[model samples]
Target: MTDLATPGSAGLLNGKRLLITGVLSDMSIAFQVARIAQEQGAEIVLTSFGRALPITEEMTRLLPAPAPVIRLDVTRPEDLERLPLEVTRHLGALDGIMHSIAYAPPGALGGRFLDTPWQDAATALHVSAFSLQALTASCADVLEDGASVVGLDFDASLAWPGYDWMGVSKAALEAVARYLALYLAERHIRVNLVAAGMIRTVAARAIPNTDHLETIWRNRPPLSWDVSDPTPPARACILLLSDWLSATTGEILHVDGGLHAVMT
Candidate 1:
């Protein structure tokens, strides 16, 4: 295994034990973070679900080291209940947890926000927002002192062409993090979100007109963007999970290539 330097000392996450979710493919931001975290000497345990377990297991081998996998379908009560023990069996205690999971039903995207069903919208909010809290609750005991919780998000202050319900989900996710920040602070645990620009992934492919949006980002962003790369945001997640951001909590760190600040 590759060894990383300690936080400001350089090995940022050295000797940390982190739990990462939502790694469906190599293009996933969580996958990249897991890779870099391991390179920096952190031990990682991954979470996946039923049919997707095999895929995530395959992807885990691509990390800097082979990681143990735990089953976690946030939508299921049983899975969440079992996750803690399953993870502990692999790694004694976790120093950090990364929430890279988000989902919405098919009709939640595209140009049909008004046509989207309540069930789908509810699913989005639950998976994208509430699950953060749920995961935190389940993993709280295992979290070492001064632990950190990191989540992936998109800027949700405005509407985007095809993001519809998922945009709503992200906004809710931001608020959820803030609330988690308040509750976990007394325990010396921090919670934060990273608002990243659009990146091509299995999840992004579900959004309609991604190509058109990519073209817009290419011309509009002051810093160039690569839709295929999620490493930038992944690194940002690593910093938040490390001691470098000890005082930072309930905040949104933008890793969008400065797209949020540039004026069209």
Candidate 2:
């Protein structure tokens, strides 16, 4: 939607302030999104917790202009309550927020879908889904009335090899996005998701039977795709965050090489 002719061009997100979470490694999609967002002129503030903070700080150096890292443990009420202050300390106000955080205990994933205890499943939902609501509320005062909120999503309409409880959590996340969109509508804020295809990130490796999962994707995608390439989804995110998609909200933009369209 940006006037820039070439994709990934500069100035698309000019002068915007963005808060990005779940940037734990260089290979993470949030990391690429942050780098591209900064290249497009958005001032980025990345969030990390205890041990991950120093590593995330190290990752920031790789950015075009190193962004400051902030402490935000999504499950912590105190952390969520104080996010606005920390964000304002570095960047005055937020134009967009990208929620890329998700986690499931080992018992909740793998082939233990039914065996996972309620506590684990609940933890999955709280961190992977409910945190979106918590985050939006915590940052509400700073988020502009017309600001955009985007989250990373996996297609949860169907089950996957080892995604297990995380798959259920993603389904909850989809619903969470819809609800957030409705709730934020009156405020002129936009809430949407990018339901991404498989990418070989740290989180992906934890899932069991990834090789089979990759096979299904490789054979299914209408457009050629690389499991290692995150640019497509990252680009979609920046587009949503930019003024280009001001009219769009409560939508799921699938960046999976058109795989979801195929019935087989």
Candidate 3:
């Protein structure tokens, strides 16, 4: 029998230097990723700002490796522009980037899809989709050749209830991942998105009618899904960031407990 804790299996992310964003609380997927990455021997830098910074600082103490926090508000141009320099000073170089940042105004979600204004929709697209481009570009110089970029995503093909314009933003995020993969191919940088099941984080719980979505999701997947269990998606992100997925790019790997495949 194989020992699951052997270095080969356990240190899949050994020596990888990554920048992880979007960690708001311990319940977040990004928080789990940061913790697991450190456990697997990876070095990480976390990003946060404003009121969220204090919370993320408290979270850093929970990781095995001490991750330094950086102030990177994706919407702020100064923050984006200075990222490369800051990361260089902090981590020297980046082997991977986990784009966990995404936001949509309340008006853009919670069943306001048809009624959402252009401004709200624009905010969603810009923050949730375009920011990927901005973040990657800002870190391009520091990204080592063969760097892997993974973004958190939800199924954008289906019109999800209560998600509204955020659904459209996720779709745009998918397209952006594809284009980034194509453009970065020359540099040997790979980009992919892990389409995850609805996890009960602060963001998900904020959505209106989420209880209804969660009820259907629990019974729908052939392989059982727990709204609280983030292991599957977090593991998928680690796989993408490691050398194990050297040739996989522009892909959407579903960590949704087979719900997407079985749903009619």
Candidate 4:
């Protein structure tokens, strides 16, 4: 409840209700999305799980308006089952969902692709890739028609030095999004992803050779890429979450400062 300035007039998501997940800190892209969503007049509920719940609750205090933090571990079926009830209690039906959750066990990341065990890889796939479907399905009862589902992504088109299984998971995530978009189309619910460039978030830092990944951005993108700013990608998420992209689904919006388009 740190009362920041509200937007002067109706903003992009004015009067919309949103469910934003994976907001662990101020540096989190999800955190920036929540802040901007509030400025744009969207009512948002954030989700964290287990040990991260308290941290996310603290982060909510930094938003323009007070947002309730709900416990949701996408890997846990019990938590998924309670999601609709929890969302209904807070914001009734949802207009949009920001699925920013992603994780891979240490064994599955950092150049261990060949050495990574099946259990570790499976964990990565479940939490990082499959959670998108699980999350959307869990909230199906609460999501309104024409609702948007936007997930955060890194460019999964190529193999990087240390991304390893997480990269595989991201590739799987893209497929999941496309399938979700196709299925949810019947309900007019748009599902898309924003493939962002590397930013220095806690999760990004955990990956070995992140500097090499950042170096690629610095050298290749026609438009300059800022590793410190989450604003560009966050804004992309906002646009996808808004009705402006009502006709767009099963798409991947690149917010990587033109890097994804470069030949190098």
Query: How many steric overlaps are in each model, in order?
Result: 9, 0, 0, 0
Expressed as tens digits, the lDDT of each residue in 1-264 for candidate 2 is 332322234588888899999887778889888988887878889999988889899999888787899998999999998999999999999999999989899899889987999999999999999999999999999999889999999998888878999998999988998999999999889999999998888778878888887787787899887888878898999899998988999899999988888876
Q: What TM-scores do the predictions have? A: 0.95, 0.95, 0.95, 0.96
User: Which runs of model 2 end up more than 4 angstroms from their true locations?
Assistant: 1-10
lDDT, model 3, position 211 = 92
RMSD of each: 2.6, 2.5, 2.2, 2.5
Candidate 1 lDDT tens digits, 173-210:
99999999998889889999999888998888888988
Whole-model lDDT, model 1 = 0.89
Give the TM-score comparing model 3 with the true structure, all chains together.
Answer: 0.95
| Minimal lDDT window, size 10, model 3 | 1-10
Candidate 3 lDDT over 27-104, as tens digits, reads 788988888887777889999999999999988887765789999989899999999988999899999999997889
Pairs that clash in candidate 3: none
lDDT of 4 by residue, 42-115 (tens): 99999998888999999989988899988999999999999999999999999999999888888988888899
Sequence-dependent TM-score of model 4: 0.96
